[model samples]
Target: MVQNWSVFVSVSSFLLLLLLSKFILRKTRQHKSLPPSPPSYPIIGHLHLIKEPVHRVLQQLSYKYGPIFALQFGSCPILVISSPTAVEECFTKYDIIFANRPHLLFFKHINYNSTTIGSAPYGPHWRNLRGFTTLEIFSPTKLNTFLSIRQEEIRSLVKNLYSYSQQSFAKVEMKSRLSELSFNIIMRMVAGKGYFGAEVEDYEESRVFRRVIGEVFALGGASNPGDFLPPLQ
Candidate 1:
């Protein structure tokens, strides 16, 4: 009977503490102006409100909350803008302010500690990288040197399509084919060889490249739990 009474007291104390903390937090936030946010749980925040087909869910939220609203996913605060005018203002007028990439785990590890052009924050390092790519890689003179590579890849794609179509109308998956075509063209230009299609110099190396790149593309766009949840990180 004594143990049961103690357990009840402990539970009551925990609930009281939770309530007090929430009240304090609410009072603290009342001083600042934040965008309209749906009610969120303490730790997980609005994470539980999100579902698959995220774009659709966000659209529905936009209808209820208006063009601009805020969300909390774990410890991270997110600003969702559904207005084209707001998007334009962010990209054009305040581009520099929004240029920094989010510090995600994938960028930390896979992108060589966030130093790559895509992962790096906006600053001198990024400017240097951009300048180098502009002058050395994407310059007209440099692209002209790889003109034959592009032409050859396009011809190969057409020939493959023709051959496949000759034997009745077989459904060609353009998405994968186009992906391979683009990847092969880029790899050939960068490494002096393609990693996809039948023209690969090393089959094993090409297999590894395909697998690693496929995983990168798959994971790059995924909403990782570690990215938002500090405990998970």
Candidate 2:
């Protein structure tokens, strides 16, 4: 029993020493290789520096640091490339290195763990999907076929605005009206029917669908921290 205990203790001690050595070596290598960044606070790294509308903050930081700079966000190393020249270089010279997008929490939930074309890895499947989308949905012939529908939709929107403008004490939110018109037009072309029936004017269901589409677009437009900090994602 003593011999077994002694052997177990010896093995555990060896493993502990090996892990410690590896941690120290990794730290040294990281310190030597990575580009310099702003000092980070414990646990959160440089997250405190990120203000509301993160793009603005990043743009400001780019002016102080070089166009291409590294930043730490919660133990993750983030590379920010700001200048047009630096972006061009990344695409032209270092395309392979930069092609892999950081996985984010929202992406995982929305895109089914990166199975979709937008988040899929660079491979044959992605290439195939791109080819199919281009050939089927984005072809010139497909778009041309919908021209008449688009014109009719635009005319309808104009008519609605004209009627509203003529009303007593008229006040209209152009943004909301435009959003509804755009969503209805797109839906009609893609789905083979508008949210409202052809004879129906200003249907409640159409308004609801348009509002939902607007909300979705607004959500998609904003950036999430998980996009920059992949480990947290």
Name model 1 segments beyond 4 Å from true.
1-31
Per-residue error for 107 in candidate 2, Å, reads 1.9
TM-score top scorer: 1
lDDT of 1: 0.89
Error of 2 at 188 (Å): 2.4
Clashing pairs in 2: none
Candidate 1 lDDT tens digits, 1-233: 99999999999999968966875586358526778888887667799999989999999999999999988887677889999999999999999998999889999989999999999999999999999999999999999999999999999999989999997988888998899899988998988899889878899999999999989989897888988876588
**TM-score to native of every candidate shown:** 0.87, 0.69
Q: Evaluate all candidate structures by whole-model CA lDDT and list the values in order.
A: 0.89, 0.73
Q: How accurate is candidate 2 locally (lDDT)?
A: 0.73
Residue pairs with colliding backbones in model 1 are none
Query: What value does the lDDT take at residue 231 in candidate 1?
Result: 59
